[model samples]
Target: MIASRKQWRCKVNSCRHTFSVTSGTIFANHKLPIQTYLYAIALFVNAVKGISALQMARDLNIEYKSAYVLLHKIRKALLEQREFTTFSGEVDIDGTYIHPAPRKANKKIDRIDYRLKENQNPEKRCILVAREHYTAEEKAKNPLYRGAKSTQVVTFGETQSTVKHFADKFVERGTRINTDESHAYDVLYAILRFMHGKSQGRIP
Candidate 1:
């Protein structure tokens, strides 16, 4: 579904409250086309290396902070997408530590050794993306990444909220979910059961 059609809905089931995706987002009141935001995501994914928000805004024909908000939203959507898609069947997970790019020096200075120790890595991130050999093509159509299954983006946090949300929207209840030995999934039982209730009216 397109983001333009996003409806305000509460994250909690017990509440009948409704809210927009922007409710808790940085782009809440911004006046811009949802497509522009989508484009920002495309740029982030397609960028060979990191690109500044200013460059993104220039390329997308939008404001600099608009670009920043767009990037923020893209990351937000990525998190949601990753949360929804549970890794099942021969899942592969990994982590990476990215080093900060060297700042441009005002003037040439003597070279100084400033490297991290052997075990002390730079800023690290945990990625949680999944794959299913049978559902690869079908899942690729998901709006989040819209890329090939081999490169489906991963996410942070192990809460079942996202997995359950995905199941409620796509996967059928009782449809077994698979994952690595990450104990994070231990919380899925209740989430899965809760989602099953939400899926009843939608799934045939």
Candidate 2:
């Protein structure tokens, strides 16, 4: 049997199924054209904070349900294709607390803000960041050096166990690590087999 423009036909007697360009892929079994699917993918990838399904539907002129399914499939495919890499060389680690969005209240009550007060919110979210510092020569040659070097971000409390866990998981042994004078990082010396450097000031 001859294969059509968009489908392939199997020559074997046992398997004569026909499939399109999107066969066995996330875009399969969709009514939209391949170009529309590709355009949606481009929008999804380029969105830094990510786009909602409703926005995607409006942009692609498709139904909300279709957009939702399309976005989910795209995310699943991307997650399946992702790879993890360990960081080496000089790495800077630090943690910062992020305050939750303040609840909206009446004008008079809203004026009494306590967000700036120290220790006002003990359950604030913590963000742990580990960034690889590049040498001068490496920075010059690196194409993605327009901003900071590659960084790994995790959400966890600032504790000795958390710091040590991040180091063991993402950092390679013998790699130099720099951090501020926080007691939480003390566990790194015992657990992570790396050269540790403490700074009195904040890590750049």
Candidate 3:
């Protein structure tokens, strides 16, 4: 006799174990209906900028905890499982200071807060980005041809030590490094025998 949809029964003499559609799959032990899974997947796939767990919870009419777990499982499956290679060839690096969003206005207080001003705030965070430039031949064969092949994002102060540390960790020796006229990158000259190119203005 044939088994039901996604259901199976072992015919072995020692065991006649039964299992359902979710057996041995990521969807195993799921209480929600199959249609719910399909809908959730469609939402995730169709989202252009990506969706948050709270948004998914609202869309699926499910609890936040369930939506959070479901989203993580889906993300884990979609991520590429492999080792990352260090960046080589021409590399561009830059740093920028990111400020937190302004706090919401309070009806109780009418006075402006001077401490949160741009110049007065010492809580600004810095982000350093390294992008590897690709050649025409590399672009033609690469799946992601529109942008840099490898990128590293580091969160630290934009200082000489930070820049040198980032270069040592992500960039290969003897590789040409390109950046705007920033004194922080001066350390690269002493650390490695790299071809350093400094631009007069902002680099595209």
Candidate 4:
């Protein structure tokens, strides 16, 4: 530890790496004082309707551009570090293709069946969306959580692997997942079951 700079240095003879407590944190390479970041956080949290860059600039006495950039950085850090709470209650899942539609050939003889697996585009992808609804009873208990409690977006299509991964990561045991009769959802039933055997109505 370098007491003068309050930084740590690694020494391996051939390799030397220097870092500080905030080296990889949001405060990394920060020009403003550490207390300023805490004060900014306080302002951000207390803003009921949400604070604007101009407002933040006036409150923090920083440039509008600086406040804007800082606000976005804080938002990005929150998204990256936020702990995801799995959905509960009635859940609806659906997916749609996100790639270019198949194009027909110019000539009749040149035409090919694009519906075939071999003719499908390799760049094709699917965007999946899932939402968990809040019951009226639950909403009455807490009006703040009305409508959909949680929404999850899947970058890939509905498949065995994707279904299993989604269930294991973003869903709790015994939560009814409403999905179409796609073969992909078949795996979800097995995911929440005990080691001995599969449970009935695990996901319907």
TM-score of each: 0.40, 0.63, 0.52, 0.46
Local distance difference test, candidate 4: 0.73
**Predicted candidate 3 versus true structure: per-residue lDDT over 133-197, tens digit per residue:** 88768888885765565544546478998888888888889877777666788787522222336
Question: Could you tell me the TM-score of candidate 3?
Answer: 0.52
Pairs of residues at least 3 apart in sequence or in different chains that clash in candidate 3: none
Task: Name the 10 consecutive residues with the lowest summed lDDT in model 4.
Answer: 190-199
RMSD of each: 14.7, 6.6, 6.9, 10.6
lDDT of 4 by residue, 90-133 (tens): 66666667674567888999898878878878777776666777
* Global lDDT scores for all candidate models: 0.53, 0.75, 0.73, 0.73
Clashing pairs in 1: 8-19, 9-19
CA lDDT, candidate 1, residue 84: 45
User: In model 2, which range of ten residues has the least summed lDDT?
Assistant: 190-199
Best by lDDT: 2
Instruction: Write the residue-wise lDDT of candidate 2 on 1-204 in tens digits.
Output: 344456678888898888777778887777888898999989998899899999999999999999999999998887677445677787778888777546656687555456566625666677887777788888889868654444444464789888888888888898787777677888775223223463333442
Which of candidates 1 and 4 is the stronger one according to lDDT?
A: 4
lDDT tens per residue, model 1, 18-84: 6666666655665887677667667798888867899998998987987886777676766566534
The CA lDDT at 6 in model 1 is 68
